[model samples]
Every structure is written in C-alpha cells, then in structure tokens.
Target: MKKLLTFSKQAVLIAVPISLVISIYVNSLVTILFLLVFLPDLIKNFKKNNFSKNRKVFFVFSAFVLVYLIGIAIDILYGTANFRKSERLLPFILFPLFLLFSDALTVFEDKKTPLKIFGIFVLCFNLFLLVNLFTQTVVEYNDNSLSNKRWKKSNIKILENSKERYALFPVSEIHIADVASRPDLLMERSFKFSRDTLITRSVYVKSNDDVWLLLRQFDGNRHEGAWFHPKTARVGFVQKNITADIQKLENGWSRISVTNRVAKKANRERLQITFVDENKQYDVKGNVEYQLYVGGTQLEIGDSPSDYMPLQHRNFLEGFDRTTILNVVEGHPTYYSLFILISVLIIILFFRSGYVQFLGLVLNLVMLVLLGSKAAILTFFILLFLVLCFNFKNRDSRLKLLYVVIPLSIIAILSFSNTLNRFNQSLSSVTEKNDVVYLSTDKRIEMWKSVIDLPLLNLVLGNGNRHGYELLESSTALTLNSHNQYLEAVLCSGFIGLILLLFFVVGIFFVDFSARNNQLLILFVVLVGFNLFFENLLNRQWGIVFVAFFLSYIYKLGEVNE
Candidate 1:
C-alpha cells in the first residue's frame, strides 16, 4: 500500500504539468478539479515531523490559515455567499492537507530524489513555454505591424477556431439626429447609430484635407451620446437624386463639392447634402449643412437647409457591453511563474553550485521586475536605490551611473510623452465625443478603498477560496475584487489566514537569505507582495496556484542544510 501510494504521488508529480498543458485546450474546470482533489495530500506534505521540527515556520503557517478562515466566517455572516465563497472554502481544508503530506514526506523519505525530479519537470516545462512564446511572438510580429493597422495570423487563427462569428470595424462612427428645434442647427440632440449605418458616408481625411468648411459642420452635432467605441471618423459625400447632375466623385478622400442651380421660382424645397453610410442612413440638418461646404462651393449649391431639425429619427445603439478574460489553462501564465521560481530554488538547494545560485538570483529579480506585483513595479527603483545605499555590493560605481541614468530617463520620457499624449487624445477625441457619461473613475476608487478596510481578525482565518468579489463589493464603488492583497486575505480567510500568509511571505524571505537556497526568492516575494496592492491576489486559479507553488519552493529552499 505504501509503495502504491508513493507511486501515485510520483505519477501525480509528473502528470500535473502535462494535465495543465492539455487543459490549455480541453477544459479548465476539469484541471482545476483535479488540483483540488490532490490538494489535501499536497498540504499534508508540509506537516513534516509534526511541525515540531520548525515550530516558528509552522506557527506562521497556522496563523496564516487561521486568519484566512476567520475572514471566510465574516463574509458568511455578511451575506456574501456566492461562487467565490465556495472557492474561499477550498484552501481551508486543502492547505492543511498540503502541510500534513509535506511533513510526512519530509520525515519519512529522502527529499533529494523527489525535489530533483520536480526541478527537472519545471525546467522542461519552462523550456516549452519559452519556446512557444518566442515562436508565437515571431510569427505574430512578421504578420502584423507594430502600428496595429494590420492583422496577425495568430489572431486570425483564434478567430477561426472560435465558436462565434464577428466582424472587426464593421460599424460606422458618425451619428447625427434628424430633428432640430430651430434653424441655427447647432443644438441638435445626438443619438446612437448602428455600425451598419455608419460606413456609407465615413471617410479618412488626411492632414492636408480642406478643414475650413468641415470644421464648422463638425461643431453642430459631432458626438451626442456616450462615445465608448474608439474608431476613426472623417468626412465623405453621399449621392442623392437632386444632385445627380453633379459628377459622382467617390475616391475615398475626394473633396466633395456641390453645385445646385435651382431657380428662385422653384417652390421652396430646401437644398441639402445627405450622407448615407453603412452604419446609418440620414439627411443632414439645417444651416449646419451649408456650413459644411467649401467657400465657392457654398454659392454653387442651393438654398440653406431649414431650422426645424426633426426629433423623429433617432437610433439607440449601444457599444459592445460585456467582456470576459479568456483563460488558456485553469489559471494564467503568472500562475506557472511561481512554480518556475520554486524550481530554481530547488536546483540551488540540491545542486549547491554557486553558479546556479547566482543564476537563480538573477532570474528571480528579472521575473519580479517584470511580473512580481503592481506594488513592486511602482517601488522597485526606490527599493533598489535604498539597498544600494545599504547592503548591496558594488555600490559606488552603480550608484553614480544610476543617478545619471535616472534623471536622464525621466527627462527623456517626459519630453517624448507629449507626442504620445496627443496621439492618444486624438483618438479619444474622435471616439468619446459622443459620450455624455462614463464609468471608469468611480469604480476603480471604490474597489481600492474597500480593500483598505479589511480587518485584522479576517487576516488569520481565511474567508474562503472564492467569494472575494462578493465580500468586497459593498465597500467598493464598483463590482470588483479587493485589489489589495491584505484585504483579499481577510476577505478570503480571517486574521488566521493573514497570519498564514505573512508566514508564507516571511518564510520565503528568511529561507531566501538564511539558507541561501536561492536569492531569487526575495525578488519573487517582493513581486507577490506588490501584486497584492492592485489586484485580487488569490481569488483566481492563477493567483492561487502561483502562491502555492512559490511557497512550496521557499519551504524547500529553507529546508536545505549547510
């Protein structure tokens, strides 16, 4: 029975990554279930020698779990039960199981073989991931330009493989209301227009295009509704029967000029210019139409458009309303990053090579710099500078270089930034001109504030595995997860859960520095801590898996003996 159990463990150890890879294509739910089923055994492994061998580490771990659980209780009390609530429940039982199994394994068997095998698995997996990412990037870039004006094969492939059918840029952007109160035509109400109705009259105007006539027309009803979709819009002409005598010049950027010869005695039918586009079909309103024609062309055309803009023809169009972030695996790429960090630590622990140790440190720092956490990105330069001032070696030369480079970098970025801002605002102006209201501001602030209010008690006992968004929503302005990690910890567990988390963080740093298992652990820890500031740190599969995998690595590193 023991032999069979051992064999099962080894099999799982090998099969987990394979399963994860397949899950990228098959089903994320199944992969997640498989991990959940195996979690208890995984946690049990952490309970080595009854945790008596490392009392401090065990206490830290225990406190963390306890706080997390308490948070779960709070959430339950608060009526935040939802799908995430079930997820929050998972770590409670599964985490302890991981500790238990880990403890048992540590006490009974040699760690070297298993740890080495796991390291090999991580290395191979990382190689595959790197190769895939590199190839994909190459192919993607070759097929598409950096300007984003062209499509890539990968994108096309994704579209082809998708279960749904869709069109890119199928809609026209310009929408004008048909009705107006008076002849001035400057105050017409704007309404939503269908994409299908927009393209027939939309055109791209070059920088050299005559702007005098068009700019005045643009002022009348440029954007009247919520401008959410960001697409380009310019001037174009639509042919009408009354203007059939005029040549139909339909070159995309042609200067459309109209000449009308209606006699003064011709009964008072208004002369007007009309544009029919793929997104909408509508007639131009009022004197606003005359203002749109060039100087000489204005005289060549007929009488001015009437002031009575009708309110009858309004189209109520809405932008694409919902979006879902697709997951290739049960989690995201970052989830696997923690496992990679662990593998490096394991190699340093068993190999005992200074070269490997240095390599680990470099890789760890790079990863944290890239994906550690949002907090880390914001504060890394400051922290690095502080370290250089204190404990970091080769400080003098680097400090001088950094001092010069930092100021120069800031100045260069600022100088070039105006160009970037103009480019962005140009698009924003064209797209959002129609929007009367938007929801970007209040929602972000609300979620952030809610995260800050998590209580200490909730930090120990985890709230649960899943209910992060539900628990934090009340305190937030938007329907979002607690972007702060400490709050996420309290929301998921309780004070006890937080303690376990603190233990997890502290353990990684201590092991990183004391055991010298892999110096990279410090960077990884920093990254995770930083990420906690802006994102719900552990509600998603990627977050959970990454945290677990990294902690396991830290433990392995700490256990390495001199």
Candidate 2:
C-alpha cells in the first residue's frame, strides 16, 4: 500500500506541472481541469496527514481569503454583486487549488532547478507568443492564416468591440478653436470662396460600393477626403454617408470646420443619427449615444450627468492584445515576457549561488518596471535613494541613480512642454482640454478625497476590491482606485487584511534584507509599488500576472527529494 501510495504521488506530481504549464499558456478551461486533476491527492493527504507544521502559512493565507469573502458577503447583502466586483473573489476559488498544487510540488521535487526552469520556460513561452505578434508575417493575422483563424474564435468579441469604421476624408487632428474668424455662410455641402465665391456645390451622395470624395472651391482648387465606411449592414453600428456638403468656401477652402465638444454640460441623453432622403423619410438609423460626428471628426460620447450605464465599465483590455503586438513591433516596452522569464531565471541562478540580497533587489526592480505602475516606481525609487544614500556601498550607484532620475525627468519635461499637451489634444481631439498637462497628480488628489468620508473600518476593509467605485460613487472624480497600492490595501482588506498583506510584503523585504540582498528586494519593491499607482493591479491581467509571478517566487516551497 505504501509503494502504491508513493507511485500515486509520483505520477500525479509529474503531471501537475505539465498540466499547469499547459493550462496557463494554452486554454482557459485547462486551469479548472488542472486544478481538479490533483483532488484525489489532496483528499488522501488531508485524510492521512496532520497539517500542523505548515499551518501558519495556510492559516494566514486562509484568513486573508476569508475576510475578503465576508466583505463580499456584505456587498451582496447590499444588493451590489457586480461582475467586476464578484470576479475579485475569484482567488477564493483559486487558492485551495493552488495549495493542493503547492503540496504536490513540495512532495515530489528534489531539486530547486525545476522551479527555476519552469520560470524560464514561462518567460520563453510568453516571449514566443509576443514575438509571433511582432513579426505580423505570421498568417494568423491574415484572414487566410490557419493559426490566425483559430484565434478568431478567441477574439470574436474583442474584434467586434474594438471595431472602428474607416473614414473617406483624412481627418485633421484638432489643434484649437479659432473663435476669431466669422462663420462663412454657404448652402449645405456648398463651398463659398471669400464673401461671394461659390467654389463647389455640396453634393449628397450614397453608394453600395466604396468611393472617395473630393471637394473643389469656386477658385477651382481641390481638397480630397476618403469615405471610410461605404457599405452598411443593419447588424452592426457602422458609419454611413448620405450627403457631403462643402456649403461655404472662402478663397480655396471652406470656412467651416468640424469641432467636437468635450465639456458639454448638458444632462446626457442617448441620441441617434438618422439619414433622410429628399423625401424627408428616415433612410438609415444609428445610435449616436456612443458616437458623434463633429464636422469630419469622430468623438466618443461618454457618460454625462443624466445618461449613464452603471455597469458599462470601461474595457481597457478592448484592444490590449493587438496594441501590445503593435508595441512589441515598435520596440516600445523593449523587454517582452521572454525577457522577464529569462531575467527571473538568471535571478534564480543567483539564489543558488547564495547572492540572495542582490537577487531580491533585482527582482523588485524588474517586477516594478514590468507592472508599468508609475506611482509604485516613484515610491520605490524614493525609498531606494533614501536608503542607498544612508547605507550600502557607493560602488554601483550609477544604475540606481539613473533609475531614480529618468522617470522623474520625463515627468518634469512633459509637464513643462506645451508640445506634449498639443499632441494629446490632437490624438484625443478633446477640444475642451487645450493641452495635455500632467493630469495624474490631479486624479490622485480626487481619488483620495472620494474615500475620505468612509469610516475607518470601511476604509480598512476597502469596501471590497473595486468597491472603491461604489464607495466613491458620489465623487465628481468619475472613478475610484486609490491608484496607490498601500491605499488599495487599506481599502480592499479591512485593517486586518491590510496588516496581513503588509506582513506578506514586509516578509518579502525582510527575507531579502535579512539575506543581505538589497538588489532583488528593491527590484520587486519598485515594480509593484510603481504599478499600483496608475493601475488597480489586481483588476488588470498584467497586474495579475505580476502578482502571480511575485507570489510564486516569494512563496516557493523548499524542494524535496523523491
């Protein structure tokens, strides 16, 4: 029976890692199947062994999970169970399975190398996936490509959501409103040259086929524009053209240009644009609540005072994968998943060589950067600089000094540069905000004031993760996320949960500092700390990835021999 049991352990132990790897990088359903695969082992262990020795980790982790649930229960009781909020409770479902898998890893592995190897592979796999994206030569993006076709199944919804119609006229990005000029009067789609010239008549045209439109002023000069959406179907909200009028023109150009209102104080209401023929009958109908055409530019009609969809949370992930692919191609972030994986693997080597402190600092920095959280980065740098100035050898302050100065300099430069604001105005075409000033500081202030009214316990429990939205519902800030991880800690878990979380955070640093490896600890501290500022780390996929990777690294079970 003992031999049989050992055999059982061995068989399942080997399978778990394979299963986890497959599940994580491959399929959504695999996570569940992998978790379920080890149930028999978990049950048998629970029946046969007493969990006293390692219960402290389990107890602390479990209490954290439980208190989080109780907070959710309170939310549900208040009739506020939402998809975004409810998903925050997912760790409740995942942790037990994680524990079981952790036990399996602890039970069967003798060498620490496999864990490191797995980390390396995870990095490699992610790199591979993203690299394929960068090349774009891969047919998957091509409508005819098979691998690309397979992903169509995965991305149907995303594609549908991010869908934008191409426009016939090249849009002039908004620069500024010129209130100095008088409105040139002309017939619809007609162009007037100066005060008396009729350069061209506004031509109303529609087509079942795609076509580009050209405008000519009375002076016989021509301007060109393309119609992006020509063919229209009723199933989707696509732009349709009924008429193009260059009614009034002065000299060789039309005096009237398109402008969209970004700061409309009107109580919001859903509006739809319908096209009418000369017969005055509605020919086509499309919802304008989400879209507006100011002259030739398209603008998003966001939630205003009277018109709001409570559950219509912004889906930032809408174009994330595609955007990331573009970024990879452009070499923006520089280090892809493979880089991170390899970096982690390299640090693992340092661990084996017993350079634990340096490993800690490196890990901290890498994690902080990858998280892309600016606040966390700023905080970590400040703390690192203060500590380094007071202690540690000055031998390699070069890289550390660069780290502290670079981001701050960028922020400073952007703040003083009106060019940056003009660029933002051009991209977003939000005419109301003349410049793209550094707005993060203002947003942070608003986020703080939103939750200041909550009771101490409510603040401690965080009203439940993402519950900041509900708690700060009355604030004019438009949204709530302390954007500060420390603040999020006080908000999500009550003070108890915050304390436990802080304990875990402090534990990681202590492990690094006690081990005398400042590098590794600083790496994570900077990365996680910085990212938590601009993002609700737990609420985003990238954030979750950081969290998972950090958790795996810090809480790694000591290897055991079979």
Candidate 3:
C-alpha cells in the first residue's frame, strides 16, 4: 500500500508539470487534466493536514484566489454575476489550493528536476513552432507568386497586406463613410491606366452635373499606372484589337467612351476597372452603354460595384511577422520565452557545468531574439549582469567579465539589427499613413484613459468579475479586458482586491529574497515584477500555473541549497 501510494504521488508530480507545458500549446484539455490528476494528491494532502505552519504562507497563497472569490461575491450582491468570468478565476483558486494542500513541493527531491524537465519540453515546443513558422512562410510565398502573376496579367493591383490598412481602406477612398456622404466634393475624378493598355477608373458625384471625364491607358503590361483628369475636353481613343463591355454599376454617376476600329469583330470583353485607394487596389466590372458615332462609339457607364478583393494576399518568407512563432504555440512568445529563460537560468545555477551553462545561455539568448520581446530582452540582460556580479568571487574576474561582455555584445548586435529593421519598416508605414506599428500602443492608451474615467463605485468595488468587457463596450466599443493586470485586478475587485494582490506578490518576493542569498530567486522576482507591469499575469491560465508552481517550489525549498 505504501509503495503504491508513493508511485501514485510520483506519477502525479511528473504529470502536473507535463500538463502545465501542454496547456501552453493546447487549450483547456491540460487544465482539465491538471485538476483531475491533482485531485488525488489534494485529497492525500488534506488527509495529511499539511497546511503551511507560517501564517504569511497561508495569506500569500490565498490572496489571489481570495480576491477572485470576493469579486464573485460582489457580483452576486450586485446582481451582475457571470459564470464564464468566474470560471476564469478557477486556475487561481485551484493552483494555489493544490500547492498549499498537496505534496507538489515535495514531488522532486532535487530542486532543479521539475524545471529541467519543463525547460526541455519548452525548448522542444519552441523549435516545433519555429519549424512550423518557416514551413508556412514557404507555402505562402509560392501561393503569393502565383496569385500575383494572375492579378498582374488581369491589370489588378494588390497593396501591402496589413490588417489595419485592409480595414481602413478597401477598394477605393470613395467607399469611406465620410467620402460617400458628399461624393461630389470628395470624389477623385480621375482615371488611371497601366502601360499594358489596361485602364481603371472610379467616379462619384452628388449630382450628374458634377461628373467629370478622366482617361488613361495601360502601357506595356506593367503593374504601375497613371491617372488623368481632362478639365476642358473629353479625350477619346480607338484601339484596333480591343472590345469594351461594362457589367454593372449602382448608386453612382459615371460615363465611359470606348472606340473600337475593328467594328466587324465585336468580341464581347468585359471592362475591368481597377480602383486604387491610398492603401489597397481592386478591380470592378461595369456596363458600358455604347452608341455609334461617326468614326467610333460613345459609352455611358452605369452602376458598377465590386467586393474589394486582394490581388496577392500571402505570407512572405523574407518579411514575416515575428509573432508568427507565437501563433504556432498559440500563446504570447514573450511570456513562454520568459518561462524557458527562467528555466535555463535555474539549470545554469544548479547544474554547475560551465559548458552546459554556456550552451543554455546561448539557446535562451537566441530564443529571446526570436521572441522579440523588448521587456524580456531587457530583463535577460539585467539577470545576466546580476548573475555575473554575484558569482564574480567564485570565478576568475577576467573569465566572468569575458563571459558577460562577449554574450552581451553578441545579443546587442543582433537585437540592434532587428530593432533597426523594424524601425525602418515602421517609418515606411508612417509615411504611408498606415499606423499598424502604433496600434497596440494607441489602444493601450485609450484603455488606460477609459479605465481612469470609470465611475467611483465601479472603481471602488471593481465593476465586478468580468466587468471589463462591459466597461470597454460602454466606453470604446471594444470587448477586451484591461491589458494591464494591475488595472485588471483593481477593475475586477477594487482597491481592496488590488491591495490583496500586491500583498501576495510583495510577500512572496520578500520571503524568497530574505530566506536566501540565491541569485536565481532574485532573478525570478525581477522577471515577475517586469511581467506584472505589462501583463495581468494572474488572469491567464499559464500565468497562474507558472506563479503557483514556482512559488510553491521556492517556498518549499526555502534556503535549502543556499
């Protein structure tokens, strides 16, 4: 019975960390499995009556879960209870409860064992994501090449593929709400054409009298085109081997004149008018009413409408979003990378092999570059500096300095090059009036402004659990929660809740810092502090799991190695 019980405990211990890593990649399955696997251990711990002897331990462990519970109670009292929102807090409750009651801390006798396993898994996951990202890029590049050729041949132009640009400018600026309101004043009365005899035009006018004639022609089958608006007289031309046919037009006023010298060969070819806006380009078909003139035919343009289509929309190999790596893992790369980085640091500190530590450091630095998190990179350097400074006495000063300086130089060069490239891209976007680079920063500012403008009551008790969506909807029509975790806590549970959370974090850091002279603990605390400023760490499942596991591990170890 004793052996079986011990085996069960060992299985649960290994399963828990494995499940946590899996949760980073999969969705809710890991969380469900985590709870189920830990259940038996929870019962065993309860039976053993192993509550932390220290009162501070109890408070620190319970603070986050208790705050959530208080928010739930407030919701019930205020008649704004939401089960979905409350469910998110389950990790906070369950993780801490499991850590406090169960033998989670005692699972691995070696302090670094769990972290080493976790590091290996995380490293593998990152490599998988990297491979997937590269594969997608290659596939998309081929697709884009084919699509681009087809589009170019048909005189259609595709703009830079960006979510913000696509959303803001569709087929034409005339389709914009402001432009549509007063079409006569805002319309670009111009017709454009490329070198290959392909012509494209758009016309919008409040009254038929306001319409103006514009003409241009495609030159040598090239993608570049030109626009011409004739002020005084209408310019007409007849092509030898071309026929013009307009498809459909609605809720607009326009006219077109197409002259075909080869009248006997009336090949019905549809007129494709490619509309070019500030950021996007697409083609539309229109019906051209033709009347025979002395030498040619006059065409009257009718209602023409088209669904704005991208000519070539595909991921590129050379210019891929760094966040593509995050998509494969289905989580923020920075957050996960930080976890791996901390794991690497733990291995270096405990393993005591210079070469192994060097390799781990290199891997972490590479991961940080791929992750492209400015905060994580900064935190890494700080941690590196601290680790070197602390260990200076143990190692030769020259060797320590060499190790620190060389890695720092390499990281600096790589990071600087990456930053420069991003900056140049951002500059080009700014010039084009595409503000994708600053979208997140602007939204965060907007959210902060909205949160600050909240009512006194809501501010005090927090608007209740999951009230962030409601607040955002009322203020900005956005359904996102407070991106800042500190703000999230305050918005959910008020000042009192925020206080409890701060106490929990501060208490843990204090205990860890005071209990030992361990550099790893100090580094962990620094990372946590930096993360808290940006992310509502406790609100996320992985975040909660990370905090709970590490806190429990550190708390349990408590000056053992130091």
The global C-alpha lDDT for each of the candidates, from Candidate 1 onward, is 0.39, 0.37, 0.50
Report the backbone clash tally of model 1. 109
Better of 1 and 2 by lDDT: 1
As a TM-score, model 2 comes out at: 0.49
Model 2: lDDT equals 0.37
Local accuracy of candidate 3 as per-residue lDDT tens digits, 1-562: 8666566556655556566555554435655655675688789767776454533565676678777877777777778777764566565556666666666556567756666766666666656776776676555422322131111222222233312211222221222211211111111101122123322232221112212222222221211222211221232232344332222233332233332221211111222232322112222223221111010011222233334322222224233345556654457765676677676667566656566555556555666666666566667767777777777777543335337645664555455544334334334434454322233434555566688788878878776775545766688765666667677777778888888888777666564455456456567767776777656677776777677667656555554454
Q: Each candidate's TM vs. the true structure?
A: 0.45, 0.49, 0.62
Window of ten residues with lowest summed lDDT in model 2: 183-192
Candidate 1 ranges beyond 4 A from true positions: 1-8, 14-65, 83-134, 142-446, 450-476, 489-531, 549-562
RMSD in angstroms between candidate 3 and the native structure over all alpha carbons: 14.2
Tens digits of lDDT, candidate 2, 1-562: 8667655555543433333434434323443454565566667777766755334444433333454565565566557655444454454345433552345454443534444555545454445544564354333222211122222221111122222222332211111122222111111111111222111122222233221222211111122211222223111121222113222322222212111232212111111222222122222222211111112211123222222121111332111222234232232221232234334433433344434424434444443343333344345446555455544565543335435444654554354322233234334433344232224444555566555666876875556544546666555435556765556656655676567655544444443333234444344545554455445555543344345433433343321221
Worst 10 residues of 1 by lDDT: 317-326
- Residue 458 CA displacement from its true place in model 2, Å: 5.2
| 154-191: candidate 1 lDDT, tens digit per residue | 11111122222112211111222332322111111112
Candidate 2, residue 56: how far the Cα is off, in Å: 1.3
Query: Going through the candidates in order, what is the number of backbone clashes in each?
Result: 109, 56, 21
Q: Any runs in candidate 3 off by more than 4 Å, and if so which? A: 1-8, 24-55, 76-78, 105-107, 135-140, 145-317, 396-438, 455-458, 509-518, 559-562
